[model samples]
Each structure stands twice: as C-alpha cells, then as structure tokens.
Target: MPQNIYVDSYTLESLSNDQNVCNACRHLYIKWKNENSELSSILDHFKNDMYELMNVQVQTEDSPRLTTEENPTLITTTNHQVVKLQLNAASSFHTKCCVCVENLRDHAAKITSQNRDFIFFSRNIWIPEGARCCSGHLINQLLLKEAVDQIKPFSIRYQELSSSDVQLLLNKAQNFVENGKKIFSFDDPRDLNDDEYRLLTRVSRDNFNDFVQTSSTIRPSCSRSIRTAVGIYLCKLRLGFGYVTHQYVIGRHTTAIARELMCGGDSTDTTIIIIDRTHLHIQKSRNNKFERKTFNLCKKRSLLKSMMIITTIGYVVACIGSFMFNFNNNDAGITKDILLRNTSNILSWLKEHDILAVDRGFRDSICVMEALGLEATIPSFLDGRRQFSAEEANESRCITKIRWVVEVANRCLKQFKYFANTIQNSSLVYLESDVNCLRSHQSLSTTYDKI
Candidate 1:
C-alpha cells in the first residue's frame, strides 16, 4: 500500500486489535505511530496489551518496579555505569526482571496470585539464540525501541549462556515435554485459509495413524500430540522454509512444536502415493534428478521427475505402501509391472470390479488389470487412426473428469516448497496425504501451489 495512509483513530483501532491487525498490516501501525503518535490512541492500547502478555516472577520482590511505558529497554536510559551482562547472568537471574527485579512473571503471579507456572527466556540473554530468563520479561518492538534508546549506544557486549540455561530452553521447547494445547477454533473447517485447510484435509489424524502403521521405514516419534505437531509442521512448510536444520533457528508456535516433531528430521522417509498417474500432463522439475523424472514433449516444460502409483481408496485409505519410481519414458508400459509386483495384498485391498481411472499412458497396463479380474476406465485412443467417434469421445471425457483428481493430488504435494522447488538430492520424496477425503477438483484452491 502507499506510504501516506489515512491515519485516524479508527485506523489505529483497527490496526492494533488482535482480531483485525494481521502480521502483514502490523508494520503499518508501527511506522505510523512512530511518526504521529499524537493522532493514534490505539497504538498505546496495542503496547499495553503486549505488556499484559504473561511471562516469569521477580527474585527481589521488595525492589522498585519499572513500567514498560517509562522503561521499555533492558538497559537504563541514563549512563548507568555500562549495564553489562556476564556469561552466567541469565542463569543467575532466571526468575528476575530482564531489566530489574520486578519484571518477572513469578513476581507478577505473587501480586496477582495466579498459580500457572510461568517460564521466561530471552534472545539477548547471551548470544543470539541463547536462552536466558529476562527475569520473565519480553519486549514487543515498541518497548524494545524504547529500551535501546535508554541504553548506552554501542556500549554493550554479549555473553553466551551456560549449558544449564540452554537446557532450560530445551525443556520448554523440546517436543518430549508436555505443552499447552494448541487451540483450534475453526467453526467450519472451510474457514481456514487455503493452506491450513488443505493441510488438515490432506493429513487428518486418521492419516497420521495410517502412516505409523503402513510405512516400511520407522519414523521418529515425538512427545507432543499428533494434531499440534502436525499443525506446526504445516505452518512451517507453508512459510516456505526448506531445511530441517532451520528448526533450531525458527520460532514455531508453542502449540505447533509437538506435531512438528512428528514431521521431523528429513523428507527422505516420505513416500508419495500417486494413486493414479498419466491422467494429466504433469509438471516436471527442471532441477531435481530422482527416479521418476521425465520430460513433456508437448508443453516443453522442465519435468521434475515425478510418479504415479496404485492405492486402495474407495475414499482415501491410509497410505499403506508406495511405488515411488515411474517409467523413464512416459510412454513405457510399467504400470502393469508395478501391479504384478504386488498382486496378492493390493489386489485383495481392491474390491471386485473397482474402476481404475487412467490416461492413455496406461493403455498397455489394461490387459494385466482385466486379466486380474479388475475394471479400468481410460480415454479412447486415436491409435494413429482417425479421431475417436462421438461415443468414444464422450467416454474419454468422462474418464478424464474422473481421473483429473490424480493430477490435483500431485499438485497437492507441490504445495510444499520442498516438493515444488528443485532440491540438492532426489532422496527427499513427496508425502502421500489423505487423497479422496479432499476435493482434488481443479478449482479447489486458487493459489494452492503459487508459493
């Protein structure tokens, strides 16, 4: 938006409210208040609300207290003989104010008489990423700006926290420990933004359980609930982070860490079950080099090597097993070979006469399917002859309509940037989500893969 905004009390009110002020528009309020605080009353309200956010107790109960409005910075505004924090400062004052004795939540609890166990840590306790109790204090940007002004300019040194202090941070953040339940307040699941809804639809609690059972590989387990951890992972993926190592650096929602743990370590263990392939002209990556990589002669787009596989889902079963690799040549007749490899169990999973919607690429696989006493619905082939008759054309159209969901399903995988972008290795495979449960129809999401 334009830099010169209409700054009125109403604008301030909207920008500062939790329900109305989204992350994107917050900077607008901050910038405006910094320039014209006289015109913005709601800015004060916002700052007040941030201060009220719960944090730890003070060690020195009798010491004088410093209010956020009067003293926002950790350091004193006056030259207070260089307020320097040492290596053990965080550990020593784990329950004291970041700036003074009165800032701790524990101290606040004593005053208010609340019994919730409060834990506080700070980014400034030591080096960046060091965990120290700012004496149960945190600073919103406004208070931080004020605090920095109070401290001597360029007169500070950083001290790293000890291992014990760091462990305190781990105890608070690590998945094995219990956490506050991440609240889900969706009145209607559709109310969720596209990615959030798609995420839930794709990997419901049922799907996660199925993953635990069916995978050939053993997945690492976490201490948190499945829903919360999955939510964190989805939130992270939606944010476009590409590495597992970033977990240590990124600050995820507290509610999310548990399930995010379920989506742990690496994408290598993931296996995408392409229930049906060849229904659409799939997009291939110009970058990655993995098994199913192929090129589209018609569209001339770089095909990120991709795949399609069979699964038993009259309506989305848990992903049991996966067949990741596909024909190097798109026209190759390997679908039948893959099925032959798993004839016994998979065939039993399929009900009698279950229809397999496929594209012409699987033409060669049809005989094997029929031979195995199953039904297949594929588009009519021109077969180097004349165009299909009217009846044949209608049948092809119907088949395409039914099978397009597979294309949408693959697109769903690409919603994650790790799958959409070319990676250093093909070892990172796509994850198969609950397919039929979601409406994989083309128009389901407008910007589903834009990120």
Candidate 2:
C-alpha cells in the first residue's frame, strides 16, 4: 500500500464495518486478495469518484429545468470496461421524440428497425427501441435526407456494445454501402423523384404508393423490404424482364374468356380463332443432327417455330409447340400435331362450326380442322397463276382482314428481346414456358395497344 493515500469517508466507513463497497472497488479487492493481482482498490475508487465528479459538474452547468425530468442513464465503455457516461447533453428517453424532444403519450410514429438502421448508417446515431420521431420527418417509414442530416448527438456519447451488437452494426453498414450503389432507390422518395419513379416503374408516385399499399400482404424477406420487392417486380415488368412465376400459367378459364371475346362477331355466329406461326432464330448447334433439324430452308438460317393461337381482339389464347424448322414441323404439320395432341384441351374448347382463320401455310391443316367439325379459312393460293380472280380476290381479302390480328399478336410477343433476338440452344428448354407466360401477360393486360 502507498503512503499518503486519502480515502473518502463513505468508503472508509464501509471498509471499517466490512459493508458492501462499490462494484469497481469490490472487484479490485477480490482480485488482490485471491490472486495477489497488482490492481488496487484505491485506484478503482478514485476512478469512480472522478466519474461522479464529472456528473456533478454536468448537472450544475446545464439548464436548471433539467432537474424536473428524469435523468437518462447512458452506458459507456473505456479501456474495454463498462463505465458511466459524462456527457453534457441529456440522453433521449423512449417516451419522447428524439428529433423534436417532445413527449409522446400515444399517437407517435415509433422509429422502425429500418429507420433506426438508416439513422445509424447516415448519422452514426443509435436510437434505442421505442424511440420515436414526428411522422413528417419520415416518408414511407424512412427518414428523409434532411431529417437524417438534422440529427446529431447532443454531445459525444460512447456506448458499450457486445460482439453481437458490433456484428449487427457491421451488417447494417455493409447493407447501406451496398444499397448506395443502386441507381434507383424506391424506398426513399428523396432518392427517386416522382418523374423518376414514373419513368422506371411506369407508374406515378401516388399510383405506386397505392400499389404498395394494396400489396402489403407480400411479406418482406430478410434481404428486401415489401416496398422494394414490389418495386423490383414493377421494374422487371416495365423493362420486359417478364420473370416466370406461379401466376404465369395458362389458367383453365382462359378458353372460356377467349370464347366470350370471340362471340358476337360480325355476320358469323361461329367462334373465330386466328392462328399464325412465328420463327425465332437460334445459333447453329455443334451437333450435326440438331443443326440440320433447326435449319430453315426458306430463311436459310437455323430457326425454331412457335404456333400462336389468338383472339380477334389481339388477346393471345395460347402459345404452343416450339417446333424444329424441318419440313415435318412446318406450320401446317405443327397445326395438325396441336389438333391431334389436343394441346391445352383444344378439341374440348372448339365447338362444331367454329372458324379457324389462318394464312396460306395452314392450308394443309384445313382437312384436319374440317374432320374435327371446325372450319379452316385460308386465303386462295396463287397456284401457278399471277393473281386471284374477282371472287377469289374478294374472299382472300376478307380472310386477310381477319388473319391480320394473329400477325400483330406475334409482333407484340416479339417485342420482348428474348423472343426477338437469336436464342441460344441452352435456352431451348425454357422456350415454351417463356412464350406462354409472355403471351399470357398480353392476354391479361389491357395496357397494350390493340389492332
């Protein structure tokens, strides 16, 4: 023990009576007595006294009205040990808004975990649970940039954090940095203006808000918020990504809808379905058999054909059978295969006297359609003649008018680059599903222009 050391009367009295001392002094005493540690109780007591002295000074120098309110305890750390904070500003309480410092009994906008994270990432402030802010300061439960800028620690505050807390903060920081690299941020209205939202999502801000509200049941995942998930979906649709989902399937009621739309047409009680074949170019496969099978003699290229069945109103009924470009898989043969296979229950949907209006390529399937109690309307082929006679010309022109919608439907499907550009052999497996899903979208959507 050092000479000329002074001890406070409270500590001396406690020691003389062997009463419980302060935690720091008690810990030091235990270490010294049990293990002959070099730590001294007097020094421990001295540090505690200094911390109390600082608290006293802060209380005296600050506003007198502070005495009326409960003093908030702030936990701090020093030299890897827990210690009391000696800050000048009053720490915020759970019952008050940290931004305006107003007491909120109820009707407060509690700071959400996401808003708390954003505040920490932007301002290095850790808002405790149950802390709140004025609702005006937040847009979509996210702090505005101005609100984030306005936030500051009343004074320097050191917080003692465990390893898990440190790890959580690190993860938030990493996510913040990762999110910063995004070109468009939909969660923060400040990050994306109204016009920007409309440009990217093809919806105005108010409409987007309504969409988010309506889709609130789409629960947020660990990696994304509900708003962000909805925004991603909209962005994907607007950009023509057309990601496949469970809802992309052709529903059973699709035929009924097609029948309804095709009924009551001019001068004919028979249901009319326009059929056309569109070819998608593909790379010449390395395999000799596949390359030959996909070679189109007319276009002199490797190609794959998809048969489109659509309504007169340009609503695609079904996109089926991405067949090879070989003669056996010509438009007419593909039509016959569809009819024979009864794909999508085509036979059940078509009634007797139903009209299948198609171009010249489907002439071979005319007999198959007639046998199925269906009528196949094809334009008159030139057949070694320069042009059609007067009666043939008028009839062919009439058929052309009805057949034009299928061509427009094909063009609309090709608007997506996945169908318009040359496809790789690796993507052949997804061709049928992809085409059906895209056409299904066209059928369900009323936004697209109709011919």
Choose the strongest candidate by lDDT. Answer: 2
Candidate 1 vs. true structure, TM-score: 0.37
Candidate 1, 1-451: lDDT as tens digits: 1111222222422121122345555675466446544324322323332222211112112226755555545223221212123321222234543334433554321111011112222222222222222322222111222222222212244433332332233333322112223234222121234454455544543354344345435334565444335454544443211221222222221112212222232333221122454222234445466323444445454343333432211112222222333344443244565567763245544444445566676677789878876677677878797778998887776554444445655666556454555443333334223222122222322332232
The CA lDDT of each predicted structure is 0.36, 0.63
TM-scores of the candidates are: 0.37, 0.47
Q: After the best TM-score superposition of candidate 1, give how far the Cα of residue 38 lies from its true spot, in angstroms.
A: 18
Over the stretch 267-301, how does candidate 2's per-residue lDDT look in tens digits? 23456678888888888899999999999777989
Look at candidate 2 and give me any clashing residue pairs: none
Question: Which regions of candidate 1 deviate over 4 angstroms?
Answer: 1-41, 44-275, 278-332, 384-386, 429-451
Best by TM-score: 2
